[model samples]
Target: MRRDKDSKAKADRHALLAAAALQDHLARRLRMPGGPAVQPSLEPGAPMTLAQHLNLIPRPPPLLSEDQWSEVHLRSRLRQDSANECVICKEEFQTGAQVLLSCSHTFHRHCLASFERYSRAKTCPLCRAAQYQKRPITDGQDLFRVKCATRIQAAWRGHAARRAYRELRRHNPPKDERLRKKWAAERLQEENDRLLSKMEDEVGDLDSLFAELDASVAKSREVCDAALRPLAARLQQGLLREAEAEAASGRAAGRLALVESDTVAPAVACSGQQHLALQLGRAGLGVSAGLGAVAGAGAAGAAGSGGGEGPAGRPASAAAVDWDAVVARARARGTQDCPICLGHISRRGNEGIAWLSCTHCFHIDCIMAFEAFELASGGTPCCPVCRSGYRRRCFT
Candidate 1:
């Protein structure tokens, strides 16, 4: 009786298993595609809504073939003022799978897909237009690019910041006292070395400048010496010649004065005696015994006083010879003009022409040069033209 009960139980278990299998199959068929299949075990929740169903089971995005996408992109290129690159990536369009929005903007498909996945929106990535008609295309071209413009810029900026951080850490002083002192000493030494190098360079430039200036100064001095040598020599020669001329003139003037005094003394005395005899005869007085030895010139004077006679008031044919002698003496000292300067001697103001005892005349400035030369050379000043010893003539 126990065996019979066991067999009946096995049969009942088999029938229950078959019913469970059929129910599982029916449940699998009845559930919506991509919706939750497993029912809650503990408690039944609210029924699934249409929005929830659509959220779970999204529709597949549309795509175009390579030929169709190429034609559209070519058209965009031919259009005036069309963008040549994707704005999101900031990279030129490499022939690839891309998306064209309804707002007329285009982008790399992968880049836009990434943006949509993160933002969870159907809006245009560039224009922000909702309910956009996205036309995804397959261009069958090189599409290796993946980095977006923003991410690339962020990475570069991060790299720079990290590099700066590392440099700052290296430059900053450590906590250890010994190391900090060492760092400070090293920095100080480097700065001192740099300053020393700069100073040396400046000093070198200064030395070069000094050398250049020295060369210029030396060259100028040499040029001056060469140019002035001849002038100095000529001036010295002229000064010596002037001094010698003054000395020679002093000697000549002394000699001429001696000759005039010795040779002409007796003749001048005889003429003075003859003039005294003539004046006495005019007064009917006898000639003196002192004038007796001057009888020869007295007779001549008497003849001269007779005016065109020989002696004793007689008319003389030899009067022509006496007239010629007087004219010859006058001709020896002829001119009224100054000999030193060619200008006529006309007394003007306080500083006028000067006449000498020898009857030579000179302009003041014209004769001053020779006078000054003779004075400076320790010789007596003499007349410039005639080399005669003279004194200033007093008109009064």
Candidate 2:
């Protein structure tokens, strides 16, 4: 009877409600018979935390923290709501006797009394709470709110996950691995072929251009050589004529030396020109007489000695220089080639004409280039035509 009263008092004491759900107190350290108090660490490994060492289990859900429990009236909520039917009696609330526990589950009062009388323990059949508070009401408002919150959270989280999935899709590569590599290889090969073709075409064009230039040069050289042949023959003829004239002059000098100053030989066998000189000689005196005498003797020698005539009908003794005629021809040939540069000397522009003391003419630019070449070679500049010492003057 004493054990039964103590058990009833213990059950009543455990059933009272607290401000919030009561968590189990931490276990106290154990003191062995041979040593001081020691906290047990049943778990293994280094740097184990106190909870991990104790190996605690997690709390049940709705898992509200102590700070989050402020608005909730634990006792009032327990009294206000419970299951509509009693689980123990298997009857509805109107079945004459019903009980509400702190866990908000319902049971019949006589059913609990009969259960406690026959059983040693006081566990509630509905929730299996060993001890709990009783109230007189039943409600389902909080349960409904929890279910709605769960559904809303689930929907929101699902939407967020779908959005994340779409964003991740952007990372997918357009081509498969093998195809991407194949395309890269093909591009490389095509570029190489294009470059090789371009290089070959350029080389062929370069070779053709060089061949054309070489042919043009050879043709121009042949034309120049052909043109020079007639000019060469003309030059040779002029040189021979000059030599003959010099010989005639020398012969005239020799004959003049043989003539007597006072005697007038009647049978002079002279031409009209010789007779004129003889008359002048006889009439004149001193140096004038000597000049006339020499002239007459020269005319006689020239007429008697037989020689081929040069150029036109003229006395052989006076071989008038071909210089003036050549200069006039050059001036008339306005677009004539320069002897130095082989470029034309035009009369209309800055180049106009330039001349040397030797009577050689060329374009001003050509003369200047020739002068530069001579200066570089450390030699005196000269006319390219006659090779005479150059004394240059410009017309424009």
Candidate 3:
């Protein structure tokens, strides 16, 4: 009986200890800050773990600072207006009693008081500005004033934000746009100058080529003239001999005729024959002189036609190009247009005007282009207007 009694006592002690431990555990789980009460009965599927039980505990809402509370009350007190509207209840103020928040929103005094007491964050209903500890309300009118002031503050902040946005938008683009336009203009000017320089270089090259061609043509003509000179001289001499023989034969025949005429004395006839012979001799001399003069004139004409030497014995092609004469003729045409291009001529040295031997004028570039086309077509360069051969004479 004693042994049974001791075992029963030990089991009872263990039971008491187990119950106390469970109670302590329950108390600890329930002791969370702002936590909800836990149920006495455990759910079936799984027992609550310590971590899961702790997670179920609610966290208290964050408290506002004293300064924040003071600011909200001060701004609210200053926002009074006659037309009081309650933002929380969405109703007009009938008793001239309202509350305001630092965010400048208005609400009825009763509504704000209830909201401050119950709201988790103690913030304004409309603007969500945090409210701190409550203050003693002196009067309902003051609350109304605060509400008006808060509304005004909120409106002011909105207005400031809008103004800043507008000002920012207005002032931003001109600097970037000005830079872009300036850069573009500079690039365009550079391109124009480059093109002008390239054109000038091309014109210079063409002028040099024309000069070389003129020189070559002049040399070829000189060679031809030199080759033909001896032949021309021999031909002239043969012509002179033929003319002399013809004159001599005619003189002899005239004298014989004078002798044969049958009406006179011998001495008179002899004198008449002598006078006829003298006249015939003078006529033959005149004929010979005339032949020489004719031959000389023909030679001079051929030399002139073949481009004779100019001043200082320079070839005609090597002589100074008569740009002045070309200009004058171009002006006489009464229009600034080049006949070949039918475009206005600049008369500037760069325009490269060339004049034909016939004095017809064209732009040098135009003439060169046409000549190239003609050469490509297996033809020679000639005057478009007069169908005359082109001569490289009037260029500088």
Best by lDDT: 3
Writing each residue's lDDT as its tens digit, candidate 3 over 8-117 gives: 99999977866665564566567755543554323222345343344433223344566776776666657643254566676667554554444556666788877767
Candidate topping TM-score:
1
lDDT of 2 by residue, 191-255 (tens): 99999999999999999998998888679756754554444334324433543565556543554
Q: How well does candidate 3 match the true structure in TM-score terms? A: 0.23
Winner on lDDT (1 vs 3): 3
Clashes of 2: 3
Superior by TM-score: candidate 1 or candidate 3? 1
Error of 3 at 126 (Å): 79
The Cα local distance difference test for each model comes to 0.49, 0.48, 0.51
**Model 1 regions more than 4 Å off:** 1-67, 70-159, 166-171, 243-396
Residue pairs in clash, model 1: none
How do all models score by TM-score?
0.26, 0.21, 0.23
Query: On residues 1-396, what C-alpha lDDT tens digit does candidate 1 reach at each position?
Result: 999999999989866865654454445446746645864121112333332233332322334456755675676546521235677777766665677765556778888888889999777776687655557654323332333555788999999999998678569977899988987898889899999999999999999998998888679656754554444334334433553565556543332221212112232122233233343334533222222212223223333344443232243322223333433443476755656545565555324444443355555433433343343355554456655443332111
Ten contiguous residues minimizing lDDT sum, candidate 2: 17-26
